[model samples]
Structure formats: structure tokens, C-alpha cells
Target: MPPNPDLRQTIDVAPGLDLAATLGPLRLGVSDPCWRVEASGPWWWATRTPAGPLTVHLVPGAGVVGVEAWGEGVEWLPRHLGRLLGLDADGPPAARTELVRALAQRVPGFRVAGHGRVADAAIDGICRRGVSAFEAARSWLLMVEAMGDDAPGPGGLRLPPAPRRVASCDPYELHVMGLEQGRADEVRRVASHASRLEAGTHDGGAEAIAHLAGIAGIGTDAVEHARAVALGDPDAVPVLDAHRTAAVVRALWTGAGADDTVDVRSLLEPHRPERGLLVRLIALVEAADAADDDGGLTP
Candidate 1:
């Protein structure tokens, strides 16, 4: 028999609180083992919490979102569910700026995703450092299947390797999953301090990012990426690599070389208080536009 949910909670929703838009950032790709979505239906998420593994199903409809979760970690999922559902996210205030005003038109009532498990997100973020999303997603899946446990319920899901498990990994093992030596060591370093990292997660983004940045191999960009993916924090500094920086510069500005040397943080300053959410929104729109241009999804 399929496992029954150990707990159930119905979260009230605001209009236009889209499941796809709110939770999209947590998913590395369509094949991400940590998540599952049915056609026009609820999505499943298998997560590794501090307590243990959890499987969650979210059903979205008018003025409400229903959540059901099971497994050893169900108890810990509730307090953090609000953070994950975009409910706790700061909404656009009066739309004073052009960016805010335009976002109001394009994706209304959108919420950024919050990853409740800081260490798990950090691990996945490490996998993503200096690589393509496809590579990151694939490496994450393989690493989980090879070292993690099966999640309860359906969708054949698996959680990311636990913090203790990651902490114990030999660099060569993670290397087999496509993590270079530096990232592999970084993974272990972060996982070794998993307790402290998780303890400080609630201390806010700056503190958490500062802690992560001090680690030998981890960069501020990766930490910010983890913060965005892990916390859905609106305050997170955006991760701007050369390619993404160029894309933003071209799409948003006219003259490039002279005026826009690097100074990404300065350019993005105006969007503060909502910078992380804004970056996610732009990516979502760009991805949709690309799909539409390519004849859209095929059956």
C-alpha cells in the first residue's frame, strides 16, 4: 500500500500564488529526483530534513494550497512549510520602480521558493558551482541514488545524501559524480559544519553567507545561490557569473564594455530588498520565452 501522510496541513493562499512559479527554483530540472510534478496537478518533493527524510505533496487551487507530508521528518516540515511556500516572502510594495512595476504586469503574486534544508541545498549548490544546470541536476541525482535513501510515497523519489553522509564522503567518491576536487572538498567542509550552518540558518542571510564564504573552496556566489535556493530569501545577493552578467547587461542595457565592466552588485543595487526574487523572476520569464520560441512542449 502507498504510505499515508503522517500529517496534513491546509495553507491559506493569496490570489495568483502559483505552485510552478513559487516552487520552480527549488527544482534543478525536470528530472530532479527531489521533486515530481504531474500534468496540471500537485507536485511531490522528497527532502532530507534535520530529523530525517520527508515526502511532501502540494495541491494548489483557488484561495488555498493543501499540503500532505510523510516519513521520519514530517514533524519538522510544518514550521518551515510557510518559508517554503512563498507565504513568508515579502511581496512587492506599491511598485515604485520600473522593474517592480513591470514584474507586477508579468508575474503577479509570484513567490520565491525557500529551501528548508540548508545543508542539502548547500550540497546541491556545490554540485552546481561552475557548471551547467543540466550537469548539476544530473550529478545531484546520481549522487543521491548512489548514496541516499528512498523516500516514502510515490514518484520513485530520493533525497539528497544526508549531512552526516556527505561529511563522511571521500573526495574521490564525489569526484565520480562529476564534482571536481575543490567542490568535493567544499562539500565535505560544509557538511562537517552542518550543525553550525543549520543552527545559523535562522540568523538571516548575511550571517549564513558570511559563514559559508569563509570556507576554503566555497565562493560568495555559490553561497548566495545556496541562500536563494535554500531560503527563498529576498535579500540574497544575486549570483552573476560572466555569462549571466553579460546576458543581464545585454537584455537590460544598451552600451556594454566601458560602462558595465563588472560591478554587478552596484548595477543590481536598485532592486534590493527583492533582488533574489527578481533574479528568479527574470530566469523564469526567459525560460518560458525560450520554450515558446522553440515550439513549446511536445506531447
Candidate 2:
């Protein structure tokens, strides 16, 4: 694909913003082919959009993010860069405790990335229910490898299968990809109604969440996750994961066992609009600590 010079643009970013740190959590894992982070250069992302297949190279400058794109969806990237970089965030909330203050200071560059793709977030959230992270990632990788198309860029990337295609897939085919029958059906249900969901996401606010939650197989948990990732609702608290809950509690309460639903909300309330980003950062820190304990092998 030839680069679209006319589509390229740069937007100013806040100081101390580490582009990698800001966007790293968006990847399913280190080996996620759709989102690539270079060791010393621009980040590459490939996705299927309403316009068409898009590949973007995001280069970070001293106080800006340079975006270059190719393909039919070229205009989407530049227009949505602010959401992607969490530019609208109110930053750290007033820290009521030293722990909260330290967390904010330690990862000042952290930001919640908004992909603005409801189908993608919905599919991911569905696959993750009642499963380990490894299992969810594996299932997603298998489905993408089986049904996705080649991306319009280098690195042999592939875009996730379009919602219509997923909506049409047979449950048996998805079952072969390691999804349970129930989950497979849920995926199909969400995909079949993806257009409506996407439209609702554009409308934004509680209506979108309500519309998504009203769908069969989608619960509050999935809605929360989708809101955070697809809609860029920084206040969206994800469904409770034991590890993530434990991590947060340990960070704040030292010897606490784990965070209950109410406890988690209370802990994050101080951060307000940046709560989702902060939660993700705490998870990242916990994952790093686990890696260290396992002698650098990620759990």
C-alpha cells in the first residue's frame, strides 16, 4: 500500500507522555500482530474500519505524535488521535493517600487508549469471560488467523475478521477454534448486531452502554470493558479479575487479600476520569512483578 502523504499529520501531545506506555495495554499480548511496538521507533497498527483496511505508523516526538497512514480509512486515524492518546483525560486525581500519589507519579505517562471499535472490544470481552488470559488470547489468535484478511502494510499483519463475517460464521467452526458453544454463540450474536452497536458507540454516553448491555450474552462486565476500550470512557471499571483485584488491594492496603467490588470502586474513585487508566497501570505493575518472580517469564 502506498503511503497517503495527504493523510499524514502530527498532533501535539502533553509533556512526559510516553507513547508506548500510553498505548501498550491495548495489545492482547507481546505477540499481537495487529498492534506492533518498535523498540526504537514508530508504533504500527492495522485494523478494519468502516472506510476500509487501515495501517498506521505513530511516531512520537518531544511533544507530539506523528501519524502516517495508508488505505481507505486514512482520515479516521488523525481525527481520533486525541482519544487514542487519552489527551482529554484530567490526569491524576487528587491523591488522598501516599500510595495513590506514588502510583500517579510512577507512571505519569500512562494513558488509556481508545480504539473506537465496538466490535473489536465486544469480541474480546466475550472471549475473555470465565477464562484465563492465555486461553482467551489463544482463542482470539486462532479465530483471527483462520478468518482475517491480510492487512494493507508490511510485517505480514492481518486485520481481525469483519463483524459481518464473524456474524455469519458457524458455531462449529468457532468451536474448533477452542471457543465453548455458549461463547461461540455469544460472539455470533454480538457480531450480527455489530452495526447497531457501532452506531450506538458513536452516539456515546449511557445510551451506548444500555444498548450494549441489552444485547443477549452481553452483561455489565462486557459493557464495562467495551466502554473503556472502545468508547474511551476513562471511568469505566472493568469486570473484576482476581489477579487484577488482588494487585490493586495489595498496592493500597499492603496485606489485604483482594478487592471486592465495592472496595475496588472506592479505591479508584479518587482518580475519577483517569480511573480506567490507573487500574490498567496497576495491573501492568502487578504483571511485571509476577514476571520478576517467575524469573522473567510472563505468567
Candidate 3:
């Protein structure tokens, strides 16, 4: 395979960036790259970087998968992993709609084109097990640094852990990284089968979700999220997320009680295969609102 590209960049997010407020909803940081959902200028974006301004972009065919970008480092993150950032891997119809629509609205000029690695997606699921986005990201940062490949960049940040690494981690060690005993055990269990998954055993995103649910601590929501990130299951909607659920409620019924729209199955009815798109639309709307709070970008 051809070597990956150099996608690292160095744009600054001006002065009005809010770490917690902007990324409070989704668990972006719960994996190797450590994602942070952000918005800059007219575009609401999500990224993974320790510092610098956010700049989301799309790059095709890097390494064995596509690359996605965000942050100054994106001007320069090796091309291999960068392309995965904006990956819109095939998923259920509903999921595709949600991701596409969300990206269109949030990332302006964004396009879903590229392949992503299954291994990265699996690790992302483990880090996100039953926690807030911040919690997941923090945990992921710790895990990736603790056990991952040496990243080929200035900071020396490690690449995400390999499948065997995840499978081999002892339960005790996992707890140290904030994972409960059961959750830790689940990570190891899933890791053992990571190779099988890496082989592309599952048929569709639904099959992938089913496999994820078979692992411990992973339910429908976790399964869906993992599929989206790992298997590129566009139709996989993270129905279990609080913000997504709340957004769905608001979109369907402006003044309705939150409880009225809590049913994920129903909320996704209209979009069918593109259920995730509805949630993403709501999420973009919310992200855009927050970005507007500071009188838009300084530019």
C-alpha cells in the first residue's frame, strides 16, 4: 500500500473557544485520536487534537482507510489517519442521511468520501462505554498513551492501541484507567475477537451492531456509535445518547415534553435507514447555536 499523506495543519481557533461547552454533548475524546466536537466560523465541526484551532477536512485513500482532519496539526497529522476523520463509510440508509446532513450543515463544504479502519472504530467503542463525551475522551487519551503505537509526529503521541493490546490488557490495569471492572473485562473480551472483526466478518452495520452488543457494557447505543466510527455504519444511530435524544425531541415537537420524544425507534421512523441523520441534524443545529452565542467568528 502507498504511504499515508501528511495532513497536519496549524490554524488557531481565535480567542473564543470553549472546551467544555462546545464538546459537552458527544463523547469525541473516547478513542485513539481523542476527538472534540467544535465549531469555527460558520462551520460547526468535530475534531481530535490537544491544541490549536479546529479545521475539519476530507482526504481520500490514506493507508488502508480514508483520513479526516481538524485542528492546526491536521495541516500536517500523517495522511493515513487524517482521511479517516471525515469517513462516511457505508451504513444503513437512515444512518447515512443523518451523518451526511449533519456534516453538510455543521462542517460546511464537508463531504463523506473515504474508508476508515475497523480497529480504530473498535477502540473508540471501548473508550465510550457508558460515559459522558468528556469522560470517554479523557479515558481514551489515557488508554492510547498507555498502550498504542508510536505516533509519527512532533508530540510523540502514540497511535491507537492495536487489537491484541486491547485484548491483552488485564482487568486491573483497565480499572486504573477509569474503566469499571465489568467494562474493563468487556474491553478485553472484545479485543480477543478484534481480529475476527478486522477480517470484516460482520455482514452489515446491523450485524456489526449485534456483534458489539454481544460484548459486555455495549448496548444498542454503544453498538451504533462503534459501527459509525469503526465499520462506517452510516445508518447506525446512537439512539442512547442524551443530547441526540433531546435533539430529536426538540426537532419533532418544539414545545413537547422531553419524555414525549424519548423513544429513539419512533424518532428515527421518518428517516428509516437514515435515522442517525435526524439526530445529527439536531446536533448540528445545537452546535451552530452555541457557535453563534459569541457573535459568530472574529473574522
Q: After superposition, how far is residue 266 of candidate 3 from its true place, in Å?
A: 2.3
lDDT: the better of candidates 2 and 3? 2
**What tens-digit string does per-residue lDDT give for candidate 1 at 1-299?**
77778888788888668788778778777878889887876889997766777899999888888898888889778778877887776553345568756765576757866866666667777777777767777888888887788887765788777667878978888898899888888888988876656523466445665667777777666687778887777757544444555655554555545656656566667777766656666666666677788899621
Name the runs in model 1 displaced over 4 angstroms.
90-96, 199-216, 238-246, 256-263, 295-299
For candidate 1, the per-residue lDDT at 152 reads 79
Task: Give the TM-scores of the predictions, in the order they appear.
Answer: 0.87, 0.84, 0.61
List the RMSD of every prediction in angstroms.
2.9, 3.5, 9.1
Worst 10 residues of 1 by lDDT: 197-206
- What is the clash tally of candidate 2? 0
> How would the candidate models be sorted by lDDT, starting from the highest?
1, 2, 3
Let me know the TM-score candidate 3 reaches against the reference structure: 0.61
lDDT of 2 by residue, 13-112 (tens): 7766777666766656566667887878578888877778888788888878888777787766665666677775545434555654676566677666
What is the RMSD of candidate 1?
2.9
Candidate 3 per-residue C-alpha lDDT over 1-299 given as tens digits, one digit per residue, 9 for 90 to 100: 42233453333231333223223223343243533222332212233332333334322222222233434545423432322333222221223454445444454423222123343455566566667656766777777677765544333235555557777877777788888886677667766765444313234334544565676554455556666554434356643435555566666653444465366577567666655545554665576777688677421
**Comparing 1 and 3 on TM-score, the stronger one:** 1
Q: Which candidate has the top score in TM-score?
A: 1
